[model samples]
Target chain A: MYAFFIRTFEGSKTQVELLKEKIRQDGKVLSEEVLKVDSFLNHQIDPVLMQEIGKEFVARFSDQNITKIVTIESSGIAPATMAGLILGVPVVFARKRKSLTLTDHLYSAKVHSFTKNESNDISVSKDFISNEDTVLLIDDFLANGQAALGLIDIAEQAGAKIAGVGIVIEKAFQPGGELIRKAGIRLESLAELQSLQDGKVQFVGEEAF
Target chain B: MYAFFIRTFEGSKTQVELLKEKIRQDGKVLSEEVLKVDSFLNHQIDPVLMQEIGKEFVARFSDQNITKIVTIESSGIAPATMAGLILGVPVVFARKRKSLTLTDHLYSAKVHSFTKNESNDISVSKDFISNEDTVLLIDDFLANGQAALGLIDIAEQAGAKIAGVGIVIEKAFQPGGELIRKAGIRLESLAELQSLQDGKVQFVGEEAF
Candidate 1:
C-alpha cells in the first residue's frame, strides 16, 4: 500500500525520515521508568513538525478529496487540525466523554487506551459527518490500533467513506500495524518503531536495536 | 489596552477586519439554532486566518516574553497552538478530564461551560508547567470567562506568572469580559460581541461585524 502511494507521486520517503529524526532529537523521555515522550506527543504540540506531517498526509492522499478529517480529541486535535488546514477540509473531533452540549444522536464506540489502561467512549456529532462524505482519520500514535478502530467505527456509523488513516508513529512490533493491515484500510505512518530497549528508540528495517 | 497594541502595528487593523469579515461570511447557522462555524473553529483550523490572529497576538503582547501558552482542551487548542507557533513557544493544554496516562501530581481546576451546560475538571501536568514560567492564556471564546479562569488557576497552582490573556471572541454583555477586566489583568480579544439577537451577529465596535 505504501509502495502504491509512493509510486503515484503521493508520498515521500525523505519527509518521513525527517519526521523520525525530529522525534529522536526533540522528543524527550518524561520518566526513566516509563519511557514516554511527553514534550511532543502528550504535553505540547510542535507546530513546525506537525505542519510538515500534515503536509505529508495531504500529499499522500491528495487525490481522495476528503470531506472531513476525523480524530479522537485531547491530543489528536493538534495534528488533525494541521492536516485539515492543508487538506482544506473540516475536522470533527470525537469527544471522549458525553456532554450536554453533544447531541443525543451521536455515533459512539468504545476505545481502549493501552497507555492509560482504561476504556473510554468516543463519539462524534452526527451532523458534521454524512453519508456523502469521505473521511481521513488522523492520530498522534498507533500502538494497538484500538483508537483507530474506534474512529473507523464512528466513520462507519456516519456512513462516510474511509479514504485512509494517517498516523504520526506506529509501533511496528505491536499488533497495531498488523491489525490495521488485516482490516484492509489504507494506513500510512510517518515513523515505525521496531523495538524499544534500554530506553532507546529503534526504527524498523534497521539494526540499531 | 487594545489601542496600545493597535498603535504598535498600524496595518493590523486591516487584518483584524479581514478576520471579522471571514467569520461573518463563512460562519453558518445550523437550523437557526446552534452557531456552527466548524469550518474555521471547531472542525477546521484555518491556517491563514489563524496565522493572522497569531500575528495580532504577538503584536498585542510583543513586549512580554511568553514562556508558555496555556489553554483548555477541544476548541482552545487550535488558536492556542497557532499562537504558540507564531510566538515560538510551547503550548500546554489543560485536560478536561483525568486520564490514566496522566500522573497524579497535577494542578487541577473547575470550569463551568455555558455551551455544555455543566461543570468539569481541567488539569495540567506538573512537569509541563513550573514556577519560573510566564504563561499567556489563550482560548477561542471568552463568553463566561470560566474556562480562562480555570486555566489561570492551573497556572497559579504551578506558581507560573500570568502575563495576560488572549481571546478570539468575547461576549461583551456577559460578565466574562467584565470579570477578567476587574481582575486587573490585560485581556485582549480579537472580536467583541455586543449581543446575539434574532439570529444575528452584532459587534461591540464599528470595526466590523
Candidate 2:
C-alpha cells in the first residue's frame, strides 16, 4: 500500500479531524453574496499556512519517487513551489495562455474552471517533462476533477508516470475526489469539506452536506 | 544613490557587455516561423525571467523600507514573489481575471500586454494592499511603460507609497525606461539591451541583456 494509504487507513484519523476543526476556525466565512472562502483559503490569506500545508503533503507522499511537481499557474504555483522546495524537485506550472517564453512544441489539454465559468487550454513546455518523469500533481483546491484530469492528460502525452495527486483541500461532496479515486490513482488531501450550509463551512464525517 | 542605481550605472556597463557575449554564444536564431526574442526583450521573455532575475533585484533594493512587494499579475508575479521572499515582505499579486475567490470590492486597473497583443483588467483585493503599505513594483520588462504605469496607478489607488520600480531587463532603446526616468521613479534593471542585430542580442553597456 502507498504511504498515504497507510496514513489514511491506519495512521492518525484524529489528526485529520483536528485539521478539519482548524480549518473551520481559521477559515472565515464571507458575505453570502461572496463565495465560501473569499479570504483565507482561496483569495487573500497567509503564506505561512500554505507552506505548512506543503510540508504535510511532502510527508504524506514521502515514499513516492516524484520527479516533477506539476501545478496550474497562479495560486497553485505558490503551494507547488513550496512542496517542490521540500522534495528538492523542480516545479513546472501549466500556463493558462501561451507566452513568448514557452516552447512552440507543447503538451496541451483543455481545462474548465468552474470559478470562472469558462474553458481554456492549459499547456506545459515539451522540454520541461520527460518520459521517465514521475509526476506529483499539486493544487490548492479540488472541487471538480476537470483541472486534475487535464493535468493527467498532459502528463500522459509527455509519457510521464503519475505517482499520485496531492491536494491541500478537497470538496469531498463534489465529484472531484470521487473521480480521482475511481481512476485508481492515489489521492491525498489535507482537509475535506462536506459542504457550505447557510454560509458556514462544514466538514465531512461530522455532519451535513 | 541606491546601490542598484550605482551598480547599474557603473557595474552594468561591464555586465551588459558580458551578457551580450553569452547571448551570442548560447542564443539560437529562430526561423520566421518561430517566435523571435527581440520582441521578447520588451514583451515575451521579460515576464518569464522575472523570478530568476529577482535574486539580483533584492540585493540592489535591499536597503529600501518596503512593507510589501506588489506587481500586476499574469506576468509580474514571478519576480515580485522572489523579491518578496528575499525582502521578507509579503508579495501580493494582482489578479488578471475575476474568479469566485475574489471579493466585489477591489483596486482595479487595466494593463495592456504588448506581446499578447491584448489588454487585461487587473485587480488586488482591498484586504491585500493598504494605505500603510510601501510597495516595490517588480516587473520583467519595461517597454512602452503602460503596464508599469497601470501598476503605479493601482498602488496610488490603494494610497500606498512607492518605494521604487525593479525591472529585470530594460530595453534602453525603447522609450519605456526613459519615460519612467522622466517621471522621476527609481528604475533599476540588471541588464539593459541596446539593440538586436540579425537576431543577435546586444547589450547597452558591456553586460548581458
Candidate 3:
C-alpha cells in the first residue's frame, strides 16, 4: 500500500512538471507583469497537455464533491470542459457583455480586466445555476482575481455552494492569491509564479529543484 | 466486411441523431432566426455529448490530412478542443477584436455577426498557421457563413491548405451552406434546420422519421 501511494504521488508530480516544462519552453515573457502562453494554453491549445491538466485538477479536487464546473468564456472554456469531462459534470461559462448593469433573467457581476483596462459585465443565465448546486470554479490565469470574484459573486447570487477555485497558473506575488485564501476558500493552483521580472519565470517552490 | 460497414454507418447515424434530439428537446426559438441552445451547447456544455461530437468529427474528417483545427472564440472552443484532442492536432481559435482595419503580426478578417448585428475583426497570430498546415475549420453554428468565411480568409492569408469545414448546426434555410459549397469547400453539418417557424424546429431530413 505504501509503495502504491508513493508511485501515485510520483506520477502526479511528473504530470505537473510536464506542464511547467511546457511553460518554460514555449512561454514568452512579454513584460514584468505579462507572460504570453498564447501558443498553448489560450490561443493555440495543445489537447494532450490540456487532458493532463484536466486529470490533475480532478486529482486535486477529488474530495470536494463538486457538482458543476463554472468558468469565464473564451480561454477558460477548454480547460473547464476538460475538467468537466473527467468529473462527469456540466460546465458553464459566464458571458462577458459590454453592458455595465444587470440584465433580466441573468446572474450578473461587473468584472474589470486589468490587462485590457476595461470593465465588462459577466453574466450567467438564471436557468443554469441554482441554490442546490455545488460548483467548482476554474480559469486559465489568476492575476487580479477580478474574473474569479465575479464568478463567485454570481454563484452567491444564485445561492450555489462553491467547492473551490482551481487555477492553472497563479501569480504568487499578486494580491489575488492572498485575497482568495484569506476569504477561507480552498484554492488550488497547478503553477505559482513567484516572479515574472527580468523576462524570466521563477516558480514559487523552484528553490527545491 | 459488409456487416462491419453497416455497423459503422449505423453508429455514426445514431450519434448525429442524438445531437438533433438534444436540440429538439431543449432548444428554444426566440424568433424565426434565433435558437437558444444555452442549456447544453454554448453557455452550459455537456461534456459527454461533446466527447461524442469529438469522435464524430474525427470519423468524418479522417480523410483530410488535418494538421491543425481552427475555430472562432467563445462557442466553438469546446467542440473544437474535443476534436483536437481526438485528432492529436493543436487547436487555434481566432480572437475577435474590435479593430476594423488589419493589424500587425496577425492574420485578420472582418466578420459580421447577423445575430448581434455588428462587425468584429477576427485574428490569429501569423506564427500559429503556416503554408505547411492543412487546417480543418470548425464552428458551433453556420448561419450567414461570415465567421467561416473569415476563418477561410485568414487561413488563406497564412497560406494554409483548407481540408474542410465542420459545423455543429447549420441553418439550411440560410445562404451560408450554399455559399460555402459553391466555393468548393467540403462542408459537413451534423444537424440541419429547415425551419424554426412558430417556435418549432424542423430538421431538413425529419420527414423521413
Candidate 4:
C-alpha cells in the first residue's frame, strides 16, 4: 500500500494552518457568515489530507485512553475513520437516517444541523457501545454544537465515558465551541475560524482549545 | 502511522474468504433475504478489517489505471478511503442528504435502497469528477443495481470512464451483481454470498465471477 501511494507532502506540516489555507484558497464564501469547504472537506475529499488530519487528532488526544471514536453520519465519517485507523479504535457513527432494515432496539438522539437548518433524529445500534468504553466524538465541522452534543448525548445514553470531542474545524465565534467548553468536556479542533468575514478566515490559534 | 497500529495479521490472508467468514459468523440474518452486517460494516466498524478489505480492492483493480475511487455516501466511504490510501487516488463519495451549503452545479442520480426500502437522490460535486478520470466504484454491499447504476450514471454524466465496481459483499441471488455484469462492467466482489439461510451463509465461490 505504501509503495503504491507515496509522494512528497513537505514531510512536516501544520494541520491547523494547512486547513486554513485550504479554506482561504479553495473555500467558497457563500455569504459573509458562511464558508463552504466542499473541495477538500466535504463534497470532494482529499483522503491523504484526511489521513494527516486523523494523525493530528491522535496526537492531540494522545493522553486520553480513547476506546471508541463516535461521530455522526456522512461528513464526519472520513476524518473520524482516519482517527480510528490511527488510534486503533472502532468508530461507531450515529446514523442520521435509519433504513427500514434497522433494528428497533437502538439509542437515538435529535440533532440540529445549523448548516441545513433542520433537526433530525440520529441513532446508534445498542450493541455497538459499552459502559466500559471511553468515547471521543469527532466531526468535520462544529457549529452551534448540535451534532457534537447529540453524539455526546447518545454516548451518555449508552453509559460510555465521554473522552473528548475532536473537530476538524470549529467556528469559534459560534456557540458550539463555547458550549462544549462550558460543559467541561475536552474538545480539540484542528482549525478554528474566528470569523468568516469578507471571505477571509481568521484563525482562533492557541485559544481554540 | 502504520507503526502505531501494526499488529501481525498473516500477510497471505485471502480477503474474500475472511469477509465471507465474518458474514457467516458475525452477520445477523434477520430473514431469508436480509443480512445485517452493521456491527462491522456500518454502525460500528472494525478498522483493521476495513484496511485489509481496502488493500484487496487495490489488489483486484491494480490494473485499468484507476485515477479515482468513487462510491455513494456513508458505508462506502471507509473502504473507498482505504483504497484511496493504498492506490494514491483521491476518494470521492456522493452525498445522500444535501447540506444547505451545497452548490447547485452538480451531477445527480436517484438510487433505490432495497434495505432502506426508499429511493434517494445522491449527488456529486461537478468539480470532483472529470472526463480524464478512470473511476473504481466501491461499496460495502451490492444488493440492487440502483446505487451502482446511479453512480455510474453520474460518472457518465461527468464523462469519466468506469474502471470497475468493487463490492465487499454481493448477493448473487439478487439482480445487482447480474445487472452490473450484463452491462459489460468489471465487477469484483470480495465475498459473493449465494444464499443466507437459517443463519448460515452460502458463498457464490470463484464461479461467481
Where model 2 places Cα greater than 4 Å from the true spot, the runs are: A1-26, A30-45, A97-104, A205-209, B1-55, B97-104, B207-209
Clash totals in order: 1, 12, 0, 0
**DockQ of all predictions against the true structure, Cα-based:** 0.32, 0.09, 0.52, 0.55
Runs with alpha carbons beyond 4 Å of true place in candidate 3: A1-13, A100-102, A207-209, B1-13, B100-102
Q: What's the TM for chain B in candidate 2?
A: 0.72
iRMS, all models: 7.5, 9.8, 6.7, 3.5
Superposed on the true chain A, the predicted chain A of model 2 yields a TM-score of 0.81
Interface RMSD of 3: 6.7
Off by over 4 Å in 1: A1-14, A25-35, A98-105, A114-117, B1-15, B22-36, B43-48, B98-104, B114-118, B206-209
Best by DockQ: 4
Q: Write the per-residue lDDT of candidate 2 for residues B141-192, one digit (tens) a residue.
A: 6777877877788889999988888876566766788877787778987766
lDDT values for all models: 0.75, 0.66, 0.86, 0.81
Specify the CAPRI tier of model 3.
medium
* Candidates arranged by lDDT, highest first: 3, 4, 1, 2
Docking class of 1: acceptable
Q: Write the per-residue lDDT of candidate 2 for residues A30-140, one digit (tens) a residue.
A: 632223443434444343444456667778888888878888867676667556655656677777863334446888888887767888888877767889999998877
| Pairs in clash, predicted candidate 1 | A91-B43
Tens digits of per-residue lDDT, candidate 4, A1-209, equal 12223242556667666676677788776765677888776877778788878877888888889999998878888888878987778898888863324547788888877676777889888888889999889999887998888888888998999989999988888899888888889999888788777666677653311
Winner of 2 and 4 under DockQ: 4
Evaluate residue A56 in candidate 4 and report its C-alpha lDDT on the 0 to 100 scale.
78
Lowest lDDT sum, 10 consecutive residues, model 2 chain B, at B1-10
Name the weakest run of 10 consecutive residues (lDDT summed) in model 3 chain A: A1-10
Q: What's the true lDDT of residue A91 in model 4?
A: 92
